[model samples]
Target chain A: MAGDRFPVEATHIMMFARSVADDNQIYYDEDYAKTTEVGHIIAPPTFVQSSAQFNPNYFLRPKVGQPWFGSGKEPTGVKRDAGGGGGGGGGGLHAEQHYEYHRHPKPGDVLTVTVRPGKTWEKEGKRSGKLVFSETITEYRDQNGELVVTARGVGVRTERPVDQK
Target chain B: MALKASQLKVGDTYTECLVEDLKRTQLVMYAGTSGDYNPLHTDEIFTTKVAGYPSVFAHGMLTMGMTGRMLTNYVGDGRLTKYGVRFTSQVWPGDTLHSTATVESVEDGIVNLKVETRNQNDAVVLSGYAAARVDS
Candidate 1:
């Protein structure tokens, strides 16, 4: 669990603002941001996923299954098998993510993010054997401790066979 | 003055683009700021040896942000009423992302549009619909 003591910076906010294609002057223009309800440039809803507060080692590479990569360099470091003291395993894939926003994100506002494992279950698939679906609940709050957004999504986990695309 | 929903025809199109480094440094920064630490994005060995992805990739929400920016820029403020998206594919580092929207339908004061996010290859990475209220 992280604290509000560490707030998100302005530069990162701006970077994410621009990254979400065609960000408007309201997010980049100081004059516009000052007059808006948020009183500062607000971040796009999509920027919620960029937070670095959570440790990637836990969610990105769970040791139970292998993650499917399209075609890029492989990720390195970290103990891939640290979950429950099991032998190292494979990676997983993000199946879906959904976000609901209460208010637009603004500049100069301190944000505190908290992430928790939402749920875990299994289901049978056509092509794949039994698949595991994991969901995580991510909540974002403003400097005043108001709930700004809530995101819940599933990540599909399965073992990567040697010759499967 | 609000644009009239009746004026927007189906099949209308809008586009935009941006450039940035989608490297681990930025990923780490986002993870730290956003509280998303999925190893498929930040860890290499875990991604390769375990996950089997070629390299770490960008978060789906990061791509969706690009989609939202397109709408805000196309129609200006107070114009976008409702927006939603479904992630269909994964985007990797250094991949140039492009977003576009096509008008789908309009009823009464409501206007519908099809929003899409594609990579350099023009593959539809994310596809969904958007609804906005036209000021009469």
Candidate 2:
């Protein structure tokens, strides 16, 4: 069974940070952070993304059932043969990432991250007739569980064409 | 009122200073800290031959971190409302990063800043905007 996702404590954020780097005083220095407009410490722009480490079951799903994925542990789905036959063979690759933040995350701010899949479709290319693209969305919240940041990332999945070697 | 773009007149700039870490040790430290193992940043052969870079380089976030530090140091901590940037160019080791900010506009207590980072080569390594609310 999967464990329930908990609110991200302030200390958790600091722990993931590389503290020896003096450049990160904003996250570690409460006195320094109080002087800023947000009036508290703030996480780096990519802080939200770096804050959480997801289990492989969630991340490695797209690569399963494809030859390029090399024997993953997930249960196999139907594979489509590229030649319009019965065999399905393909894999996934990271395509792009985008982030939007409403405010700087600070100490004492409890965070909850929710992740889900987005668009999925297939298209034909000059060389390949049908290729698929999948998108995923990750949303973050603050102590009161307020929405603060949203990230959407895309991945590309390709299946070999039926006629191609 | 939210920070307005119309408040800042063109050409308002603030200069920020950064101490140089010329030994390349800081770059190595940043690599270890950030967990970014791109060879173009840490490997000499990969950087020189594959990436065509002159030498190892700092992580993009290292420069971004320096810029954020500059903002907090300038406006005082907790004053920044939102800070963001788009990585534009590469910064090699031995490159000194200089962070700069300019008032783009202010409205409804919000101040918009045009921020940039320059290397010792005087080339902009990253450029973008930031927003924050000033005391009412």
- Candidate with the greatest lDDT versus the true structure: 1
Global Cα RMSD, each model: 6.2, 9.6
Candidate 1 per-residue C-alpha lDDT over A79-140 given as tens digits, one digit per residue, 9 for 90 to 100: 44443211134435566676666665555666787878988998875544566889988788
**lDDT value, residue A50 of candidate 1:** 59
**Candidate 2: lDDT of B84?**
65
* Model 1 ranges with Cα > 4 A deviation: A1-12, A18-23, A32-40, A50-80, A83-89, A107-130, A134-150, A161-164, B1-3, B18-39, B42-46, B77-82, B107-110
| lDDT value, residue A24 of candidate 1 | 64
lDDT of 1 by residue, B55-85 (tens): 7677666666667777766655545555666
Chain A only: give the TM-score of model 2: 0.57
Worst 10 residues of 2 chain B by lDDT: B1-10
lDDT of 2 by residue, B1-136 (tens): 2233454555677677553654456655554444443343455653343333456666566666667666655554445666666555656556667889888777777777888878787877778777666654
Task: Look at candidate 2 and tell me the lDDT of residue B71.
Answer: 63
DockQ of each: 0.30, 0.11
